[model samples]
Target: MTILICNSIIILITKTDPALQTPMYFFLRNFSFLEICYVTVTIPRMLVDLCTQKGNISFLSCAAQMCFVLMLGGVEFFLLTVMAYDCYVAIGNPLNYTIVMNQQVCVQMVAASWISVIPVVIGQTYQIFSLPFCGSNRINHFFCDIPPVLKLVCGEAFVNKIAVYIAVVFFVIIPFLLIIVSYGKIISNILKLTSARGRAKAFSTCSSHLTVVILFYGTASITYLEPKPNQYEGMGKLLSLFYTILIPTLNPIIYTLRNKDIIVALRKLLAKLLA
Candidate 1:
């Protein structure tokens, strides 16, 4: 709840403040919005399951939850990739940064990230459910996730597992590769700077985002990319809790606390409210 409120406040601050009207903050606004949707998708259902102690989700509801969670997860990955490009441009081509990442381009990147995942998620949801679920209906995890649900299937889900592998490759691995490439260039550019202060400043600007990327991708990879779905069922749930529950709460802090612009904007907003 606290994280959701903070993310909402950040979104409002980014959208309303003229000083934050740059490509970086614009991306931050969308990322904050994504965090809200991301947590809402799973946390409410988790709470309900905890209270009821049954953890039973209807077939349709489970499918819907899976689709929304996958869609939002996809969007976050793509948005982070776009953010990496934005950061690379800001550092590697400072003079052309504004021109390169103009408002229209930023809007289009965000829109594309949100829109492009619809078909993919639709296919994934359909594929996962199309398989046989003839065994116990109780989902192992607090929320309905693909691996735990797959474990409940009466028959072999070899093809479904393969499909998940493909999807993970395209969605998770590809974006990570792009981020690496972007950061490689960013580092190269940073190293070229002679002034120690300039290099430190550049690295400082990117460190928060890099930290966020590491946290998000690390847990997400373990959740989705384990060699066998059933191998780490217990560990998987813990990892899922970290990413789905904990990470959203940490994101607002990660992005804002190191951000001077956000600090200044927040102080101004506080002053305005106090006045």
Candidate 2:
């Protein structure tokens, strides 16, 4: 509920305010909307389960949920990478930032993030659910994540294991590497600045995003970047809960607290409402 409210406010303010339409805030608006969808993909069902203690879902429903969640997660990973690149451009090439991150390119980046995941997610979800679920239908985790669901399937999951590794590479590691590279370039540019105040200003633009990247990638690394195939053995559910619930809840707080532009936008939004 808090995630819903906070992220909604972010989307609303970002959209309604003319001043918040830069490439960074454009990405942020999309991310806020994505968070709403992302958390909604699981939280309401989680609430229902908590209240009634009934978590069983039909095969079709389970497949649908897993497909949608994976698609959205893939889009988010792509969006985060795009955002990291946006930061890199803004900092490393401030003179050409406006031209390079023009409105058309921004829209293309966002559309590409959403569009590029459809085939990948569909193929991966098909492979995952294609396995026979002859074993216990009970998912060990609260949500319909791929890893826990795979555990319920019968037979040796060689194909599914490969799919999992591919997903880790495509959705997690690749984006993470891009973010690292973007920030590496950003740091190099920041170091080149002669003035301490100029350096601080450049660093400030990235600090909040860097914090979010660390928190997001850190939890995701624990969840998906396991060194071993069976690494999600004992603590998968706990880690998923942390990322799906706790992280979304914290994201709004993180941005609003650390970002002056968002704070200003929020204040202006509130004052307009109160007026």
Candidate 3:
């Protein structure tokens, strides 16, 4: 998976001349880098547990894994929201897109997304880690997911529950609502275009982004937003797979497959390679 994702990023980064430094491409690279980070942060540890003779992790390692998974998950979701806004601006007002989304603003937005997610991650991780896990040593899922892992703890998990709820509202629900609002405005603007052709062109630009948002939010809403009982262990693991493993793989494909410019760029690069 790592090799595959690395090759994909290399192809994307080198598809055009090195000087093809537009904001859109820059955002693509950022997303690509995040995807790579997202996978690396969890997958190796997961595969190790599955493949190793004895799947054992120390308490600290488990805590670290949970924290990073939270950070990456939150960061990726917020980045998606930021990308939606970027698309909204690009399509809603093409002439002023560059000026409005200048380098400083872009950098600051990306940085803020990462920064904002850190506290949520820390809060949630602390909530889970502070509990006493005296029951189960093995995690049901391949990864150290909080909800399932917290069940192993033989303590009052009320603090963790409250913190997780607060973090969910702040990190996931609120940003998801913003994505919906932004897309609504974008759709409105696209519909107001003078002709069918213009509206189609504008809508095409955001469809890929919308697809990602749905997949992320739909799976996540099921996994985190819904209540989980101890008996529903299988469902918890399944939801974990959806957000962590599945989404990372699909995110790159969604961006590259539906993006017309990326397709054109890849074809040009391939032709040059063959020549």
Give each model a TM-score: 0.98, 0.96, 0.92
| Comparing 1 and 3 on lDDT, the stronger one | 1
lDDT of 3 by residue, 1-275 (tens): 74355436644654354554666666667777777777787778777876885778888888888888789888878888898899889988789988999989989988998998887687778777877779667776677777778778897788777877888888789999999999999988997899999898888888887997898888877777667556677886787788777877777777778777776667777788899
Candidate 1 global lDDT: 0.90
lDDT of 1 by residue, 1-275 (tens): 88888998899889888999999999999999999999999998888878987777789999999999999999999999999999999999999999999999999999999888889999999988887778577777878788988888877888988889898988899999999999999999999999999999999889989998999999999899888776878999999999898888898998789999898889888889999
Candidates 1 and 2: which is better by lDDT? Answer: 1
Ranking by lDDT: 1, 2, 3
Q: Give the per-residue Cα lDDT of candidate 3 at 65.
A: 84
lDDT of 2 by residue, 1-275 (tens): 79999999999888988888899999998998999999888999889889998887888888888888888878888998999999999998999999999999999999999888989898888888877789577787787888788778888887777878888788889899999999999999999999999999898898878887888778877776566646656676777887789988998898889888889989998898899
Worst 10 residues of 2 by lDDT: 225-234
Q: Which segments of model 2 are wrong by more than 4 Å?
A: 227-234
Name the 10 consecutive residues with the lowest summed lDDT in model 1: 131-140
RMSD of 3: 2.1
Which regions of candidate 1 deviate over 4 angstroms?
Answer: none
TM-score-superior candidate, 2 or 3: 2
